[model samples]
Target: MTKPSNFIWYELMTPDPDGAARFYGAVVGWTIPATRDPAAGDMDYRMIGRSDGGNAGGVLALNADMIAGGARPVWLGYLEVADVDAAVAAIAADGGAVQMPAFDLPVGRIAMVTDPQGAPFYIMAPVPPEGGGESDAFSVTEPQRVRWNELATSAPDAAIAFYKKHFGWGQDGEMPMGELGAYRFIQRGDVGLGAVMPLMDGYPAPVWSYYIGVYDIDRAHAAVRANGGTVTNEPMEIPGGEFAMNAIDPQGAPVGFVGPRTS
Candidate 1:
C-alpha cells in the first residue's frame, strides 16, 4: 500500500478552466501562465504559480462529455503511488472502484478512482526520468501548496476501510460532528491526507474537498469572494490557533485556504 504522505501534485478538473484559473489566481496569489495543450483542442493548460517563476500546479477543462456524464465539478487530489497497477488492483480488491484505468502520460501512469462510497481521487506512479519532488509553488509563500486535505464522506466505515487497505493511512482520532455521530481524522504521519466523516447536515454526499496552505486566511478568503467564488464557510480559528476558510470555485468545487492568524 502507498503511504498518503507521498502526495505531491494537486489538480482541478472543471468545464470552465479559464474561469476557474482566474478565480484561483486571485485567491491563492498565483499567476496563470499561458501554455497550450495539444490534446485539449487548442485550449491552453492554465498553469498557476508565484511571480518568482515557481511551478505551482495545473487546471484543465475536462472534456465536455465527462461533465455531461455525471461528473461533478470538484477538486481532486493526486497521490504518488509506488506502483499504479498494484494500487488500482488493491483498490478494487479492497472495496473501491476504478473510474479510469491506469493510462500513460508524460508524467506517469495515472488512474481516476473512487473510494467504496464513491469519493473520487487520482493515483499515479510518476515517470522516472522526470523524478519526483515538491512543487515549486511552495516557494511563493513560506508554507505554500497543499498542507492538508479532508473528505467528508457519507460512508465512514467503508471509506476508512478502502483508504486503509489502499494507502495505509491510519486513523488519528474521531470527534463528534453534531448529529453525524463522529468524524474521523486520518493521517499519513503528522500530515493530514484527508478525513472520513458524515456529510455535514444539509450538505451533499461523496465529494472530496482540499484545503490549501496560504500565507493569510483573511486575505485569501477575501480574494476568493472578490474573484467570483462563494465562501461556504466563513473564516474560523481552530484550537491550534490557525485559521481556515472554505469556499467554492466558480465551477462549484469545494476549496479552502489556511494560514496562521494574526495575534
Candidate 2:
C-alpha cells in the first residue's frame, strides 16, 4: 500500500463559490486568494490560506448548470496514487465506480470516483514523492494535528475491499461504536490513513469526510463558530483518549478535527 504521509489538500466544489469563500475565510482565518481558468468558462478557484501564507486548501464554483447535467456539490478527498489509470481499473474491478475518468492536471493526473456504496473521493498521481508546493500552516492555528480521516459508509466492508485493491490499504481491529458493531481502521504503515464505518442513522448518502489537525478542542470550536461554521458535535473524548468535534462549514460540508485529550 502507498504510504499517505498527510492529506495535502481539501477542496469544496460548491454552488456559490464566493459565499463559500467568505464563509471559510471567517471560519478558518484563511484568505481566499483568487485563481481562475478562463478556458473552463473562466472557472474560479479560491485558495484557502491564513494571512501568514499557509494554504489550507481550495474552493471551486460548482457550476450549477453543470449540475443540471449531473454533478453534485461535495467534499472530495484526493489521495495520492502511484498510477492513476491502474487505480481506476482496480477500483472498477473492486466494486467502485468512476465518475470522472482520469484526467491530467498541471501537477498530475486525477480522477473522481466512489466506493461500492457511493463514498466519493479523488485520486492523484503525486507530482513528487512528498507532495509539492506548500504545507498548510493552518495546523499551527489549531491545537490538534490533522490526525485521522473517517469515512462512514453503508457498505464498510466493500469500502475496505475496494481501497485494499486500489491503494493497498490493510485493516486493523475495529473500534466498536455501541450498537453499531465495529468501525475498522485502514493503514498503510504506522500512520492511520483513515477509517471506514457505517453511516449514521439518517444522513445524506455516503461521502468522504476529512479530519483536520487541531491542538485544542475548545479553541478550534470557538474559531469554527467565529468563522460562521457550526459545531455539529461538541468537543468530546473518544475511547482512545483523543478529543474530536464534528463541524459543518458555512457551505454545509461535513468536516471534523481531532487533538490529543487535554486532560
Candidate 3:
C-alpha cells in the first residue's frame, strides 16, 4: 500500500474532449486512447497514455449541464486516500468545501474538494487494477510522468496547514519570492512532491497546477505552439537545471512542463 496521502491520478475536464485529446497528445507526447470501460456508460471519457506505455490521466467530456453551470476546461489532480468519506469529513471540519459529493465508479470512490483557500482537487480511494496492482502515474523521475504538483493560493500558510493535516504533507523547504511571499516546498516523507506559493495578482482563481516531465523542452514547447496551445511564459531553468514553462492547452486548461533544454 502506498499510503493515504499521495497524488495517484490526474484528470482534465474539457468541453471539447476530442480537440483536447489531439492538442495534449502532441504537446506532451501522450497517446489518447478511447476508453472502453463499461462503467463509463454513455459519457465520453478517454485515457491519457504516457510515452513509456502507462496511463498518465484521463480526459472527461464536460456535459451540457456542467458547461451551463460555468464549468471550464481545467486539469485536476487526485490525491489517494484510504477512506474517501473520512477524508471528506475532515476537509469539511477544516473549513474546506465539497465540490462533488463522494461517489463510486468502477475504478474508485471519489469526491471533488477544494481547500479553504478555494484551490480544487480530488480525494479518491481507487480500486486496484484488474490484475490487482497500483499504477505508477505519479513518478517523479520517470520521463513523461507527472513530476511536480504546484498550488497557487491566496493564503499559502492556511492551505499548507489543511494539506498537512489531511494528507500528511510537510514543509521540505522554502524559496522567498520577494514581496510575493515564500514558495514553500511540500513533501511526503523524503519524496519532494511540489510547492505551494501565493497566487499572482492577475492570475485566475486559486488552483492546483501539475507539471509533467518531457524528454526535450524546446521540442515540446514547439509542439505546444503548433498545436494551438499558448505558452504563457518563456522557458525558464529550474533548480535541477531542467527547464519549465507554463501554458494553456487549446481548450484553455493551464498546465506546466519540465525537462531538458535543447540548445
Candidate 4:
C-alpha cells in the first residue's frame, strides 16, 4: 500500500519510556508529549513528534511480560507491504521467521518478522487515515526524522536476495568495507532505502539500525553522553558532508544519529 515495501514507521521498545522520551527529545530535538491519551486502552504508548509537528514514530513501554516473552529493548522499523497474510506466508517459506501474527489495530494490520539472518523488523498493511497521504516517518534529507535504515547481517548476500524477492528492493551502488564486505546499498524506486552490510564482531547481533536526522551532530553527541547514553561509535563525517554516530540509549537500545556538524 505504501509504495510497495517502504519503511512506514519506527518504534522504540524500552524499559523506561519516559527516560527515552527525554533522551531522544534532547538529542533528536523531537517534542514528545508527557501525557499519553488515557483512551488507548491502558497501552503505554507515545507517538513521537518531529519539529514540524508531523508524526515521527512511536515508543512502546516494554513490560515484564513482554520481556519474558523474548522482547528486548530495541528500535524496530516497520516496512509497509501490500498483503499481510501473503507476505507472512512468503517470509515463512523463504527462511524468514514471524514473531507476531498479523493483527489489526486502529491504523492497520501488522506483523513482526525477522529476516533470514535474524534481524527483526515489522511488516504492515496500512489503512490510510481519513485524509489520504503518504507517511512522513522516513525522510532522507529531513531533520528530526529517520534518515537511513541499515542492516548488518552475517549473510548479506542471502539477505539481499531474500528481501529483493519479497519486498521489491534492488541493490544499488555499494561501498567497500574491506574485510567486512561491501556496504551494499538498497533502493526502492528512486529513493535509497538503506544498505546491507556484513555484521561486525562487537555488535550485539544482526540488527537493523536506523539513523535519525539532527541539526547538529556535536550537540546530539554531547546529549547522548550527558543523558546516560553510551557512544558505541563516535561522530564521524559520512558521505554527503553530514556526520553520523551510533550509541546505546539509557535503556540499552542502540540508535544512530545523522546530521550536519553545526558548531
Candidate 5:
C-alpha cells in the first residue's frame, strides 16, 4: 500500500484536453498516451508519460455539463490516504467542505474536498498498479516530475493546521517575505514537500499551485511561449541554484516550473 500523506497523483481538468496534452507535451517533453478504462465509461483519459517511461499524471476532459456547472480548467493534486471515508469525516469535522463524495474508480477510492479556506484538493486511497511498485509521477528528485506543491490561502495558519491534522505534515522551516508574511515550508516526515503563504491580492480564490521539474528552464520557457502559453514571471534563481517561474497554460491553468537552466 502507498504511504499515507504522500502526494500520489496530479491531474489536469481542462476544457480542451487534447490541446493541453499537446501544450504540456511540448513544454515538458511528456508523452500523452491514451488510456481506455472500462470503469470510467465513455470518458477519455490520457496518461502523461515521463522520459523514463513512467506515467506522470493524467488529463481529463471537462464535459459540457461540468462546465455549465461552473467547473473551470485547473490542475488538481491528490494526496494519498489510508481510508477515504474516515479521512472525509475528519476533514468535515475540521471545518472543510466535501466537493465530491468518496467514490470508487479503477485507480482508487477518491473524494474531492476543500479546506476551510476553500483551496481544493483530492484525498484518495489508491489501488496498487498491476506489477506493484510506487509511481514516480509526483517525486521531489525525479526529472520532469512534480517537484513542489505551493498553497496560496487566505488562512495560512488554519490551512497548515488542517493539513497537519489530516496528513501528518510538519513545519520544516520558513522564509520571511516582507509585508507578505512568511513562506512556511511543509514536510511529510523529513522530506520537504511544499510551502504555504498568504494569498496575494487580485487572486480569484485560494488555490494550490504545483511546480514541475524541467532540465532546462530556458528551453521550457521558450516551449511554453511557443505553445500559446504565457510566462507570467521570468525565470529567477531560487535558494538552491535552481531557477523557477510561474506561467499559465494555453487553457489558462496556472503552473510553475523549476530546475537548472542550461542557458
Candidate 6:
C-alpha cells in the first residue's frame, strides 16, 4: 500500500540566499547557518534550521543557469510516498508533468513535478534514519514550524481531485467564501493539514503558500516590514480565531505567518 504523504520537507529556492536567511531569521525565528550542504556538491544548498533544533527545510541558491532559465524565488514542498518511480509514473499518466527526473539522494529519491494545474512541488520516498520519527517540518502550533499549507489554484475542483487520487488526501469540509469559492479543507487521516482555496485576481497562477507558526502575528508583520518584505494584507482572523497574514519576502517569495495578534 502506498503510504499517504505527509509533507516531509520544504525548500526555498531564492536568488539572494544570505538575504533570505536574514529575512526569515528575523520574521520566523529560524536559525539558518552560513554553511552550505556538502552533499549537494558545488550547489549552494543550506539547511533551514528551526530555533528549537532540527530543520524547517532547506534554501537553495539559484545559479546563473537556473535564473536565466526562468527560475524565480519560490517555496516548494516535498510529499513522501512509498515508491517514487511508481508515483511519478502515476502522476504523469494523470496529466502531470515531470519538472525534474527522479534521482537518488542521501535522504531518498526525489522528483520535481507539477500538478495538472501547473503548481510545482516535490515527491519523495524518504529514507528515514535508523530510528528517526515522522517529519517535524509540519506542525499546527509550534512556533517557527510550518503550520499550514494552503494551495490557491485556478481550478479548485480539478486540483483537489488530482491531489486526492495521487496522495490519498481527503476533502473533509469547506467554508463558503461568498462570491469567490468555498475554502475546501483537506486532511491526511485525522490530522487536519490545511485548506485549498480558489485562485483570485491577486494570485493569477496556482501556488502553495506555507504559513509558519509565529509567536505573535503583529510582531511577525512588523519584522517583515523591517526586513524589506511586503505584507499583502493586514492580519485577518482564521477559523480558529488566530490571526493570519501573507507577505512577499525581499526576493518576492510569497510567505505567510499565523498566530495570535498582540498589539
Segments of candidate 5 deviating more than 4 angstroms: 1-4, 34-39
RMSD of each: 3.0, 3.7, 1.8, 1.4, 1.8, 1.1
Task: Note the Cα lDDT for every prediction shown.
Answer: 0.72, 0.69, 0.86, 0.89, 0.87, 0.90
lDDT of 3 by residue, 202-233 (tens): 57789999998888889889999999999998
Tens digit of lDDT per residue, candidate 1, span 84-153?
A: 8988888887778889999887667899998777778888887764464544432223444766677777
- Ranked by lDDT from best down, the candidates are 6, 4, 5, 3, 1, 2
Instruction: Score residue 63 of candidate 5 by CA lDDT.
Output: 88
Model 2, 132: alpha-carbon shift in Å? 6.7
TM-score of each: 0.86, 0.82, 0.95, 0.96, 0.95, 0.97
Give the per-residue lDDT digits (tens) of candidate 2, residues 2-92.
4543455677787777666676554444566555544334667666665555656667777768779776665666777778898888888
Q: Highest lDDT, which number?
A: 6
Quote the lDDT for 175 in model 6.
96
TM-score of 6: 0.97
Tell me which residue pairs clash in candidate 2: 26-227, 27-227, 143-214, 143-215, 143-216, 144-213, 144-214, 144-215, 145-213, 146-213
Candidate 5 lDDT tens digits, 83-136: 999999989988899999999988889999999999999999889888987657
Instruction: Please provide the root mean square deviation of candidate 4 (C-alpha atoms, Å).
Output: 1.4
Residues 1-263 of candidate 4: C-alpha lDDT, one tens digit per residue: 34548889999998888899899998988876776646456778888988788989998888899999988899999998889999999999899999999998878999998988889999998988678988889998999889999999999999999888888888989999787779999998889988999989887678999999999999999999999999999998888999989999999899999999967
Candidate 2 vs. truth: CA RMSD? 3.7
Q: Tell me the TM-score of model 3.
A: 0.95
Tell how far residue 27 is off in model 5, in angstroms.
Answer: 0.7
Task: Judge candidate 3 at residue 143 and give its lDDT.
Answer: 68
Model 6, residue 111: distance off in Å is: 0.3
**Which portions of model 3 show Cα errors greater than 4 Å?**
1-4, 34-38, 130-133
